[model samples]
Target: ISYVFIVENTGNVTLTNIQVQDVLPGLMLTGGPIAQLLPGEIDSTTFTATYIITQEDLDTGSVTNSASVSSEAPRGDLNDPSDDIVDTSDDPNDSSNEDPNGDGDPDDPTVTLVNSIYDLEVSKEVDELEPVVGDEVTFTIEVANIGNVTATDIVISEQIPSGYVYVNHIATNGNISYSDITGEWTITQLDPDQVEILQVTVEVLGFGDYLNIAYVQSSVGGNDVNIGNDEDSAEVDPICLTIYNEFSPDGDGVNETFVIDCLERFPDNKLEVYNRWGNMVYSTRGYLNDWSGTTNGRAVVKDSDNLPAGTYYYVLDLGDGSDPRVGWLYINRKN
Candidate 1:
């Protein structure tokens, strides 16, 4: 079967019952009409034609084909119309198409980076830059993914940036891990534009200024474009770091107390408690590590007089809010 494709009437003289040949395969010309023909006649007429073909007539697997036609008793027509038997193939028209995304052949598909969790970014308090000398402090860092494409296997890492020492454990997204020169914290992934949360902390030991820097990177092959970028869901938040220290009442049981008065008195502004057992009986949350006098849920008060002469574990929320400091302290019985 075939439909009208093109028509051309060039002769100056009009002829009745003209015929066309060399038509497409499986198609036949039933009839057509040409109004009139003049010296400059360029009129064209088209008609729908149809035909049939059997499996036996197929050119095997060659896929090539053609057809022809003839007419008599016609003035403007040829005896045999064989030119219509041009090259005809059974293949679809649109074969080789341009693949934009670099796949192959014509296809329908696309990909994108989605929901990514970046590395930990951080900021510091205007007052304190890093940990205090010989004192523990709280350091806070907020991670973000500032990349063009979403990244997988996002790994976050940090070093004490020198001048500062690790006083306690570091935390990221609320997860605590042992801090050292060789610690690699990782998050799921960060889309081109994603953000993550994390914190790095250290205590001030030696007297010097330290510059703290945290990094976020994609896990897949290094995409120079996505490295160290902050594209987290939320905006990159600022961090406030603090530094300080505190020594419990010198091995004394007399003034041994879980009070904030003594802890906030030192240059190393960290909270602490002196348990004769050299354990921090109490601590605070950075500038507010106020202990409620309970280990998770148990009371440490003995006879309501004072803490007994014994060692106890404690957590110190020291530093510049970049990291919460923790550890042990000693409490002695003051004679």
Candidate 2:
């Protein structure tokens, strides 16, 4: 930064050997040392100086420099011969001195304020920790600015794992758009101590451990102060189930009952079967993979011992306080 000092002869006598001195380290004073200045006469030559700002200065928030002017006074006692030196130092207690900014100190010390820092933290969360297949899961992503300055043009990215399809998204303070596996959130500005939340919904196609990740991609500022909290991830494990859609209840002694893989894992489950007319045909608790073409004797068809071949619906509840699983089931007695 460049600095200019304009020294004026405010005293009554003529001053000689006028010079300027700055207390800031590494500051080099250039230009001329005026020879003499009459009363009420400002220096005609320019006395300038320059100093390079460092990272330490920026971190300190402000840089303060104090300057003073010294000169040689005219000889008054020619007979008693005395060396006279006059100096005008920056005195904060001097009320008569000029203080343009009026910070209560009349020294006129230069203070340059440095810009503040930028810090953005991201966190991710999932509504369902263990969801079933074909379930819609919602992920909440939050971005907070913990710095002192306002952040602008922030871009956050979301990475949707495989076996999951993007459904839709909603944001509190930004615009979001996504493809199949990748999504982007663009924010115009976020003030200090402000937070923005974005919720994305996706459908689980298959069963596995799905890990969704979100992070701060970029911003208009230089860089985030703390990068440790720039990214976060949420994990979900869907419960997989293998159901036999079509079953044969013929007297062949094979495939005579409905089978469901991993059903024994949840012994506290309840299975309910419904016909095409939404009528409950069979309902049982603690199913042991046993169910033939016969109903509970309440919805008997043409034959009292067996039902005709047709399509049916079933609802399986794991009794774990989760949503019940619903699907189609087929009964083929002719096979």
Candidate 3:
């Protein structure tokens, strides 16, 4: 980086032996000392200095330096060397400590901020993409520091959509807390190339589509450059087991078979049908919803015979450690 300093003789008296000096080290100055500067005369000759930026400056995020100009007032006492006073004043352009009145106090300090990269990427995933009602789904949220500098005081915000209740959360390198449908994760710092993972578990309360979103809410030490990858979301669709009460298998093409909604979601399941006499007439493991009023159990019922139209009882075991669902099923053969 290069810096230019312009000194003007704003005083009434003529200034002599004008010299400019910068506080930063290793900055080469290539301007000569002005022999004399008249009153109200802006110096035509400019003082220029060049300095190379270092990695340390980028790490700190900014560089601040100031230049000072000093000259001999003479005070009409050129013959008397002791009476000639030297006046030094800092640059007036520095806002931190400007010296507009040419005061001898130390003041000027120009700040230059280094454009440090601050990028954070967030991604989310769920263990069960399609979950069943009352099932607990685990969501994984990962945050990575893809910038060149370390991010400090990072806070991540998480939102759990409706139809789900917060169970618990675990973070690898942060403090995770939640209230109702919102969650927060706090971290002291995350260095470049470092990553953190947080796992949040929620139980599906009702049957519906639920979307969970996570993003980097705030962070200090640097500004985030890329906002596109700062947030991520995962969706889970829960299915509820539904059983149809009646079906007509008369080859009318409507309600032709006993329909069980979401029954295929449970691979390990059993279905049993019983007549009014407490005799099991049909039973099968992994029922495929193909039972069309045919007798599949006892030899007395005749395997190929279609039972008369009547109301029967059914017991379905989902094999998921839950109690079996019992309900009444009606079969109609009337045209």
Candidate 4:
């Protein structure tokens, strides 16, 4: 393989440029632009040269590669003193150059991309902890990776709040975590285009509020790569865990349920649900709950009128009293 290399100075005052002919068999030369330079300044120039490379020349036995060339040249022409090479065989009187060092004709090198360029991405932000509270609200977290190489062993973790309690055990495929204790979560390995999910449950404690910093990191050895849980937090936030729930019939039906105005208890107090026997059945942080007049998933015994045509024993935790206020509820089903 044999080819000529060329360079052209197209920058201000003739910036540098190189003459390159890729000898890589699989590569196609893509043209580039020649920028403008100052007037009277040396214009960029490139040489047309030939080169070749063989598979046996590679140490790794890979044909993918790239080559570059740089040289100092004067203004113009082979005779220009600025040119590093003072020898010019283009002269008609030059007999030594006649046959062109020229006779055998074959020696070249090739250039190409290193190997492959890959882009990986994971959601940057997401609801880290979902299915919060007994059944109040859920969280969603997201992340993404975009780069030339594939990523592995990406893990996401979060700390449990002080007062709030852990609902479920952290589930992960393959990863190392701080501990197997409740509250902490992590994801092990995530290949290109692969995504891992973490689910956590929290019980809102007290009344004030709760926000904790969580992080997701890549298994990159060195330091941090983008959102790799480095700084105080490239991505950090305070989550206001206000427990809330509802039971307004989650389907296409107008009569299935009543628009239970729950979530209104945040300012009120813990709800104290009781059976006709005066036995407390359920309690909640917010009023966003709905009693189907049923024990668990089963229906509670009620008279046909549902009005109970009578009163049912119950207790209301009105925050005011350390003890619950007991009373009977009048069933008024709005048809």
Cα RMSD (Å) per model? 17.4, 12.3, 11.9, 15.7
**Comparing 1 and 4 on lDDT, the stronger one:** 1
lDDT (C-alpha, whole model) for all candidates:
0.41, 0.77, 0.78, 0.39
Question: Which digits, one per residue and each the tens of the lDDT, describe model 2 over residues 231-305?
Answer: 999988777677887989998988899877557657789999888888778888988788896777354564345
Q: Which of candidates 1 and 4 is the stronger one according to TM-score?
A: 4
- Relative to the true structure, candidate 1 has a C-alpha RMSD (angstroms) of 17.4
Best by lDDT: 3
Better of 1 and 2 by lDDT: 2
Model 2, runs deviating above 4 Å? 1-115, 174-182, 207-209, 242-335
Which regions of candidate 3 deviate over 4 angstroms?
Answer: 7-19, 24-47, 50-64, 71-121, 131-137, 144-152, 160-168, 174-182, 190-195, 201-209, 218-229, 238-335
Clashes of 2: 0
Q: Please give, for residues 101-188, the per-residue lDDT of candidate 1 as tens digits.
A: 4534332211112322233333332234432344455555555545344445656555565555676554544432334667555666
Off by over 4 Å in 4: 1-133, 136-142, 146-149, 167-192, 201-213, 217-335
lDDT of 4 by residue, 209-314 (tens): 3454456443542233354322121122323333222222323443232122223333565555455555544445544445543332113443321322234455
Off by over 4 Å in 1: 1-127, 130-132, 169-181, 207-209, 226-335
Roughly what TM-score does model 1 have, to 2 decimal places?
Answer: 0.32
lDDT of 3 by residue, 1-335 (tens): 87777777777888887778776877788886878889888774567888876656765787787776767666555555455444344546665665555654546667777777889999999999877666899999999998877787888898777767889888785353444444677777788788988888999764334878889999876677889999999988776676887999999888988877667667788999999888888888988789999888776477879977999999999888899999999999985
